[model samples]
Target: MDASSAGEGFTVALASGETVTTRQILLATGMVDELPETVGVRERWGTGVHHCPYCHGWELRDGHIGILAPGGEPFAELRVTLLRGWSSNLTLLTDGSASLDRPARQRLEALGARIDERRLRAYEDGPDGGYRVCFEDGEELPVAGLFVAPSQHQRSGLAETLGCGLDTAEPNPAPFVVIDSTSGETTVSGVYAAGDLTGPAQSVILAAAGGARAAYFMNHALAAADAQAALTAAGLPAGSDGD
Candidate 1:
């Protein structure tokens, strides 16, 4: 079965070009943000342009920073406010997006970060080997680092096709496979999910823990099946028969 897409189902492209079927599938495909068409943004993704502050903030601490805004979705202002801790020379660019709320506005002001109302046209290499963000209004800003909140799209389309639901009540409503916190069991029998596909805020340690938990459950499940078959072959009850 060619269940390459993310989400919680199987896609089988038959070799004879006829038909295919799948019983259970787990969509563990993660999400990715498509960067803006800006020139330097793509090239500097890991070096200077970044998204997750927790992942890339520490390295750029105390450096001049710029944040591109007008995000498609609503996130807590705390996201940018938190970045203020990393650099006092931070600037927020409002590339023609909605206005911030009063409280958010006050917080941004208190952080000593300047807000750029002009639209961002492109970015290029700066003289200092940093970045030069050009505005549509022909103004330019130089910064040692840049951050932008790009819209997130699920990498797994198979999960959505199979109707795997997401935890919409929480923030971010992209479809995700349901799993037992302890066993990693999905709604569909025998399917499991782990890592970033489950939800955000997962670190390497957390992902490793999730994988371990799933493996532990799978091992026990296989052991139980083996014991059942052994007892059945011996002409005994498959489960505990008051032994």
Candidate 2:
């Protein structure tokens, strides 16, 4: 599918030779998480490997949990701290990526979390329905679950094609779509956005709330536009007159 500007509205072209036109557009396109290319990771993503602690922490509580601290993760230290709450037996797998400083190493140790800098080789099934992490150094660690800090990106490129700006801030694995906090309006007027594509709060409840808020403002904007069109068609001033 392809979309572009068409006069005062926008036009969307579908692959099946269909087109849609609208005066306003709300982009609820979400994000995509890119995991490491380690063996056995891709196949067991949602079932065994996860990215969010709040979403999956309770299920794996009090068990041996491993945090796969991949390189370039902006909040590596913070992630370890959060996951430690869910499982006292926590291990931070550096995978030959994290080089912890003295203080950082000491902090993790204080939290009773072990730091493993071994290069990860692959993952195999453990005896108890868990995962066995194999290292290149011939060492293995078994855990009930593994939390990965994945690099994320927009699921669709249509937003950029339509000239929506992105927020380039630290700690965000990927740049998110920039929108007016009060109105959910994108940098491009008449175009709006909501949900995970807008910010770091990637929860179902928050995404739904965002969509509702954007829809409220979108309805008002469309109503105003229609009123102006009616006035112009009747050969009257655009400004409101006594009704």
Candidate 3:
């Protein structure tokens, strides 16, 4: 089903025909992983195909792992090279996209990783319960795990529908909401954004900071409203601070 957006507020019409609504919307939606257009890649997600080595590498320690270079030098090569600490059996699959510089290639070679210059054709579940990656050059490699560099985009369509802007960058270039540094307030009023939706290299600690900032602003707004009500009840100008 297609996600629709309208004025006042957006509604996600579920497949079961249900609608949810709210007055003040906060889009803390995270990111979407855009996979490479390759065969068998989609079928093995999480099980064999992965994006963040930091998230999945530990489980694959001391196993034969393959790193597929989709794009970007910083994230594609550098990140996989860093994963060498987890496993001595790492293979770099170039897939005929980008190549490494001298320093980068040396580092990869030093880690005892081999490079596959052949273009990736497809991936299939290995008979031994791992993965079999086939290249266009008729070369096949068996790996316990396969890592890919997926392009990440903000997962919230609601943010974009409400006129929230985006910031695109290298490594994993994608769109994300723009917000104030201190308040987590988006360009759209009454709408606050946080987490990876705001595109700020958000880890757990950073996400907590964003939530606190938004809470602070919302609390201040509510407090000001309460103060105004008290002033009105006491027959004083709301603008006056009892001076």
Top candidate on lDDT is 2
Task: Write one digit per residue (lDDT tens) for candidate 2, span 146-237.
Answer: 88888789998988999999987986778899999988999999899999999877889889999999999998888877888899899988
* Inter-residue clash pairs, candidate 1: 6-156, 6-159, 7-27, 7-159, 8-159
Candidate 2 off by > 4 Å:
231-243
Whole-model lDDT, model 2? 0.85
Estimate the lDDT of model 1. Answer: 0.69
lDDT against the true structure, per candidate, is 0.69, 0.85, 0.74
Backbone clash pairs for candidate 3 read none
Which portions of model 3 show Cα errors greater than 4 Å? Answer: 1-23, 71-74, 101-103, 110-112, 169-172, 180-183, 200-220, 236-243
Candidate achieving higher lDDT, 1 or 3 = 3
TM-scores of all predicted structures: 0.79, 0.89, 0.73
- Report lDDT (Cα) of residue 219, candidate 3: 68
Query: How far in Å is the alpha carbon of 203 misplaced in model 3?
Result: 7.3
Off by over 4 Å in 1: 1-26, 71-73, 202-205, 237-243
Q: Order the candidates by lDDT, highest first.
A: 2, 3, 1
Model 2, position 183: C-alpha lDDT score: 85
Report the C-alpha lDDT of model 1 over 69-93, residue by residue, as the tens digit: 6632254255567788888888787
